[model samples]
Every structure is written in C-alpha cells, then in structure tokens.
Target: MEIKEVAYDHPDAVELSDQVQAEYRTRFGYDDTTPLRPSYFDPPRGLYLVAYENGAPVASGGWRAQDAEDEGYAYGDAEVKRMYVTPGARGQGLARRILAVLETSAREAGRIRMGLETGEALPEALALYTSSGYTPTTGFGVYRDNADSLFLAKPL
Candidate 1:
C-alpha cells in the first residue's frame, strides 16, 4: 500500500470520506455532523493522507490542530479524523499505517498530544487505538455528549 498526503477535499480523499460517513450512518443511525473545512488539513497545522493499492484509493485519515479548552481540548493537541479502510482492504494493517503517519506528522508539527473521538460501535478501531498506546480521555467535539462516543489520546 502506498500512502500519500493530499488535500482534505481532494477527489480521492472525498470518496473515502464519504465511505466512512456511510459507515457512520450505519452504525450511529446518522451521519456525523461535525463541521470541517479543507484548510483544516493544511500543513504546519494538520495533514490528510490517502492509501492506495494497485492505484485505487483504499483508506484515508487526517489530523487537525485543536487547542480550545472550551471544547475540552488541550493546548498543542492534534485531533484525528475520518480514519477509514475500505471493506476490501480490511486486515491489511492500512489503518495502522495511516495512523502512524498522522501521529508522526502531528508530532513533527509540535503537537504535544494526538486525540480522537470514535465510538463503541467500532470495536476494531478501539482495539487498534488501545494497542497503539492510546488511552481513554475526556470527551470533546460534536459527539462529546453522546454516550456511545469514546475519546482517546496519546502523548506525542
């Protein structure tokens, strides 16, 4: 698999994002309503990545700076978003690869911590994060008040 950094609104990135949102709708009974903008993934602040296999996009993930205490984020925090692996690409370690790159890029950008909000419906994701050294953290973001939401963080 080849992982390439791309704009959050890039065609392939948008395709994968739509796929993830569909999965979210299936699991949560609605699409995630978090407002996002392409610029949020710009360098020096954040990054967006796409993984391709045989020249077809298969996975994606990104991170954005988050430091607003009112939103429950810590200073120098980088929040992960839109992590996904296409159904056919499952079990290939693509998600792990994408996550490692996101963390590395965020860390290099001076982000002191990496944070994300997932949910119990995504057991595999929760497992991946926990095994990668992420631990439970205070909720934040749009889903903070949702009982199904699970927030996790790891110091970079």
Candidate 2:
C-alpha cells in the first residue's frame, strides 16, 4: 500500500471521506457530520492522507490544529479526524497505517499531542485507538457534552 498526502478534492479521498461521513451518521444518528472542511483543509492548519493499493484508495485520514479549551481543557494540540478504511480493506492494517501517517504529520507540524472524538458505537475504532496508545480523555472541541462521543488523546 502507498500512503500519500492528498488534497481534499482528490477523487478517491473524497469518496472514502463520504463513506466515513456516512458511517458516522448511520452509527451515531447525525444528519450532516463530516471530518474535513475548508477551515481545516485550507492553509497551514491541516493535512489529509490517503492509502492506495494498486492505485485504488483503501484508507484515509486527516488532522488539524485545535484548541484544547474548545473541548474543555487548556492546551495546544492537534485533532485526528476522518480516519476510515473501505469495508473490503479491513484486516490488512490499513487503519493503523493511516493513523501512523497522520500522527507523524501532526508531530512534524510541531504538535506535541493529539486528540480525537469517536462515537461509542464504533467498537473497532475504540479498539484501534486504545491499542495505539490513545487514552480516554474528556470531551474536546465542539463535542463537549455529547453523550455518544468518546474522546481519546496521546502525547506526540
């Protein structure tokens, strides 16, 4: 698999992003949730990555600078966003690869820590984060008080 930095407009990246958004909505009952946007995707605050196998996108993820206070803390950090792998691409470590890339990107950007919020319904995601060294954290960002959201963080 080839992991590459991709623009938000990249066709395969966009498609996988849509799949991730759909999964979030279906699993958490949200109407229009998404992991990437102009504010995060534009300028020097964010990064998007895609994993391709045989030229087909198999996994993707993004990260962006975020203020800890927004989620009920006071620290400078980066947030892991939009991590997903195609259903057929599971069991091959695609998600872990995407996460390693995103974390490296965040650290290179001078971020000392990373955080994220995922729904409780996503057992696979929870397991991945836990195994990857992300520990349970309090609500962060715009997800403060969201009952279904589980926050996790790790130091870079």
Best by lDDT: 1
What tens-digit string does per-residue lDDT give for candidate 2 at 29-144? 77334345646854367788889889999898888888647457446588888889889899999889889877887888777888888877999999999999999887866776
The clash count for each model shown is 0, 2
Worst ten-residue run, lDDT, model 2?
30-39
Alpha-carbon runs more than 4 Å astray in model 1? none
Q: Kindly list the per-residue Cα lDDT of model 1 for residues 1-156, writing each as its tens digit.
A: 799999999999999999999999999888888899999999989999999999999999999999888888999999999999999999999999999999999999999999999999999999999999999999988888999899999999
What TM-score does structure 1 among the candidates reach?
0.98
- In the predicted model 1, the residue pairs found to clash are none
Candidate 2 residue runs with Cα over 4 Å from true position: 31-35, 42-44, 71-73
